[model samples]
Target chain A: DTAVSQTPKYLVTQMGNDKSIKCEQNLGHDTMYWYKQDSKKFLKIMFSYNNKELIINETVPNRFSPKSPDKAHLNLHINSLELGDSAVYFCASSPVTGGANTEAFFGQGTRLTVV
Target chain B: LAKTTQPISMDSYEGQEVNITCSHNNIATNDYITWYQQFPSQGPRFIIQGYKTKVTNEVASLFIPADRKSSTLSLPRVSLSDTAVYYCLVARSNDYKLSFGAGTTVTVRA
Candidate 1:
C-alpha cells in the first residue's frame, strides 16, 4: 500500500484559473505537510498540519491555501494562479511520537503547469 | 535559513560507492541529521537519519561526527537508477519546521 498519495498527478491551466490538489495518507500519521519544488529542483516547505490543526505556514502568496478536513487528508487550493505558480507540489506525512517517528514519507507529487 | 551546506552536484559510476557530505556547523543539541532523495518527477523520499557516529540501514548509511558539525550519506554500490538529487536536512524537534536547501544532484554514469 502507498503510504502517501496525491490525486491529479498532472494539472495544466491558464493564468488566473483555479485548481486544487488532493492528498491523503494511510499511515495513520498525525502530521502532514505540503512542499513545492521549483524549476531549479529546489524544494521548499509551504504548509503543515497536525491532526487537522494548521501548524506551519510559510510566506506563500494569498492565492494558495491549504485545507485539512481531517487527520488523514490535506488539500491545497490555488486561486488566481500565475505563471510562476507552475511547479511540482508534494504531499508528505509523518507519525507523531516521542522521537521515534521523525521521518516524513512523501507522495509521488503533482506537476502543475500554468500558462 | 538552514544550518547546512552541501555540494551542488556529484558524479559516480555504476557499482561504486557514493558519499555525499553536508556541513552543519551550527547544529543544535537536539537536532537530528536526515537525508532525503528525489527523482525527476517525484517527491523526496526519506533515506536515513542519525544523531551521532554511524547509522546503517538497508538503503543507505549515515555517518555523523561527534560534534554534529557534519554528516555523510553513503550509498553502497550505486546504479544508474540512483541518479537523483539528495537533500540533507536538520530536523529540530517534532514541530520545528523543515527547511530544504538546493541539495546535491547525484549523477551516476554508466
Candidate 2:
C-alpha cells in the first residue's frame, strides 16, 4: 500500500472556478502538511496540521483553505482559482512523537492547471 | 526554519562520488540537518539526516562538523538514476516547516 496518496493526480479548470484536492496517509502519522511547487520548482510550505491543529501557515492567498478531518487526511480547497495558482501541490506527513523516524513521506502530488 | 545555502547546480559522471555541501550559518542548537532528493515530476524523498558528525544510510551519507555551520551529503557510485534535485533543510526535532529552496540540480553524465 502507498504510504501517502493523493486523489486526482491532475486537475484542469478555468480561472475563477473552485476546486479541491484530497490527500490521505496510512502510515499512522500525526502531522500532515501541504506544499506547493511553482514553475521555479521551489517547494513552499502552505500549511501544516498536527493532530488537527494548524501549526504552520505561510503567506498564501486567502482563496486556499486546508481542512484536516483527522490525522490521516488533509484536504485542500481552493476558491476563485487564478492562472498563477497552476502548480504541483504535494502532501506530506510525519510522526509528531517520533525522533528517528522524523522523515516526511510525500504523496504523488496533484498538478493543478488553471486556464 | 533555518535558511540554507547550496549550489544551484552540479554535474557529475557515472560511477563518480558526488558530494554536495549545504551551508546553514545560523542554524539553531536544536536543529538538525537533512537532505532530500526529488525527481523530475515526483515528490522529494528523504536521503539522510544528522545533528552532528556523520550519519550514513544505504543510499547516502551525511557529514556535519562540530560547529554545525554546514553539512555535506555524499553519494557513492552515482548513476543516471541518481541525477535529481537535492535539497537541504534545517529544522528542529518537532518542527513542521520544511522550506525548500531552489535545490542543487545534479546531472550525471554517462
Model 2 / residue A7 / CA error / Å: 1.0
Over B21-67, each residue of candidate 1 has an lDDT whose tens digit, in order, gives 99999887777888989888888888998889999999999999888
Question: In candidate 2, what are the lDDT values of residues B1-110, reduced to their tens digit?
Answer: 67899999999999999999999999988787878999988999989888989999999999999999999999999999999999998888667777787899999999
Docking class of 2: medium
lDDT of residue B50 for candidate 1:
88
Evaluate every candidate with DockQ and list the scores: 0.54, 0.56
The DockQ for candidate 1, computed on C-alphas, is 0.54
lDDT agreement of model 2 with the native:
0.91
Global lDDT scores for all candidate models? 0.89, 0.91
Over 4 Å off, model 2: A97-100
Where model 1 places Cα greater than 4 Å from the true spot, the runs are A97-100
Using Cα atoms with residue i matched to residue i, what is each candidate's TM-score against the true structure?
0.96, 0.97
lDDT of 1 by residue, A41-97 (tens): 888889988889988899999899999999999999999999999999999998862
